[model samples]
Target: MKRRWIPGCFAALLAFAATAALAASDDPSYGIIAKHKANSAVRISDEGHRIVYGSPKTPVAVEAFYPLRAGGEGHEWVFEYGYNLVTAFPDKVRFVAYDIATPRGGEVWQERGLTCGAFLINGKREVTVNGKKLSFLRSTTMSGWTFAQLKAAVAAEIARPRPARAAAPKKPARPAKQTVIHVTVPCGLAGPYGEIVHLFRARHPEIRVTTAANGIVAMLNQLRDNKMTSDVFIALGLRELDDPAAQKRLVSGSITPIATIPLALVVPKANPAGIHNLEDLTSPKARTVLTYTPNLSGGYGARQALQEAGLWDRINSKIVTPKVPDQCKQMLKTGKGQAAIIYSTCLKESYLPDKPPVIEKDLKVAQMIPQNLYSPVVIGGAVVKTSKHPAAAKTFIDFLRSEAAMKVWLDWGFTRLPGA
Candidate 1:
């Protein structure tokens, strides 16, 4: 998640602030930041205060990301983004820091421009000190940044007045009606689920979503045993819905097409194996990991592609099938496993066709499995039969097929069914 995403476009912790008459006794209260328009700027005081955004649609979340001194020397930095508290120093740096939630609307957030409280939004105020550019964030969706860049930004933002502070945005609260729905999707979609589910909640605030990302097989086992419960099941492949185990738990008529994803052969950015094509996987030198669980769908797709290429027998020996090959991107990056075949959209270069390529820094697609090589897998969703919120569950399912959800799916690299 290393971010080269917003080079020219920077989202500062700036929301529009109303001037307070130098509050009596330096009362610390930051102004709300939701840029109604550009040309407006915020005046940031050194006082560490919670910056509030006044939009009713935006939840009144009080997540504290305010800057704090790490040591007596003030040499280290501590940033709390939601539940995760990150303590960082210049000497040693951890690669990934920010956990991005879904952005509101790209066009809207950008157009409103920068506001000032912790950082500014919707405006461009790139502060360059000692030739190092200050890059902090790109909306709520963050990317990995180097320590130097982070240090520079921290120094610049917190420099003159006081300390560098990062204020995290909170979503608006839900209604008291208390109609909640639990959603289960594959682990691969967890990241996108943040954005997609956010969109769903925005449109339907009355329905609370508690999401769980697990493999279809695990879901099946849990469902049959009554250990797991989900109002909605967004599955990887249509075949999962057809399984007897799944069918018993899901309402047959409630199932619907979500998206179609083709398999991809991915490798680390280093490309140590020098793999360029599927046929290379047959070489004894290569070690590829295929998902052993067809219940997961990724493994099923990989096996299907290899069989279609007539390389299943030849490369079968080279494949390393772990019991739960859930982390393909990690395996490729960590050298735990050299190569893997997973959903092409699992980690993408771009979420939208028109957007800049926010290539996943650590990995890349060595080769995309030809659509003709095997039958492409279709992602589907259905309502659980045992759900108490059946009507609400059905409503959520219907939302998945809506134009809004389709946009989310397409932006994340899923293709719509040809006819539907």
Candidate 2:
């Protein structure tokens, strides 16, 4: 009876062992190993019941596989894994396992478990698991962590209590004050400068810019006499800086080019004289208005354009010289002249019919003076040495060269200088 009982018990034990082994083999983790084993791209082999897999195309150089047998339930499978050096994106290491189960009942190796960590080759401690928020371990040898050690590190981080955050300190009250940056721009630049100032003030509400439109020469003289307090001087030409008085007032090596102003032939809305181009200004019947202040860029540019077209003498004969380019626009609108040679920026401003007698009509820019004959007016600025707000002044000057400011200049009919 004893011998018969022993035989039956031994047979039962053998059957139970076979059933457990079959269950382990049927697990999703084992399915992933089997799938990779058949994949030509992944070189897989088994060592002591452990599935080892690697691929040159994969970021993971090599990884050892194991299943979290205790917690695995149906499609929900977890993996305890480890990897050696990652060839591609070595800083970030990810381990992924697959399963074959879906509500749609499709047979495919779907992603089952994934864990990622970062490491540095230079032996610094910056390893994070899953994301940067959950930093589990920091060591030089994180890449070499064993499966047991990696699992333990993750468990420790999850179980550890977070430290209580300290209360934030009260912020000090800010003083109610604004710094003013006095800037002198040419009369021809009033429109563009107004837009630029508006944008600058919007960005920096702490600084206030007081702008004055005057001849560049007059602005320089005021700087010399200390009559007008200015932080910056924006001139239409670099020649303005050549003045000994301006050179003395401005900081050395602070002059920088901003943009180039092209000359445009502006005509009245009706175009009563039928002047459409530079050649049209040569007509004896054409009453062409010319800017006279040669020191001002628009005045200089107008003369240059007419001289290049070989109509300076012919056109100059019918000239009604305005004090400035703004006056030139005024003369054309008031019917004092049919056409005027002025800065393209000035012509753009004339479109606004805000001022009465300035009708809402299409004042056309007939033609842009050829750049070959007369170069575009190159505008530049310098920080005055005597500025009360020197830092704010320099900040404003830098803003003038910004892409946003350059776009405003372009929209106003000026071209940005190369490297400006």
Measured by lDDT, the strongest candidate is 2
Clash number for each model:
22, 0
CA deviation > 4 Å runs, candidate 2: 1-179, 201-208, 213-221, 350-362, 418-420
* Candidate 2 local lDDT, 1-420, one digit each (tens): 989999999999999999987876765656655554454344454432233345334322222211122112321122223332221223333333321111111111101111111221112223345554222221112222443444434443434464775696675543378887777666456556666776897898888776544444446556666554577888887766776766888889889888898877888777888888889987765855656467666677778878887878776777777643345665676677888777666544421112211122446777777877675678898888888888899899989979889997887778979554
- Score residue 293 of candidate 1 by CA lDDT: 58
Model 2 weakest 10-residue run by lDDT: 103-112
**TM-scores of the models, in the given order?**
0.57, 0.51
Worst 10 residues of 1 by lDDT: 67-76
Error of 1 at 245 (Å): 2.3
lDDT of 1 by residue, 27-94 (tens): 21111111211213222122212222222222112122211110001101322221111122221221
Highest-scoring model, TM-score: 1
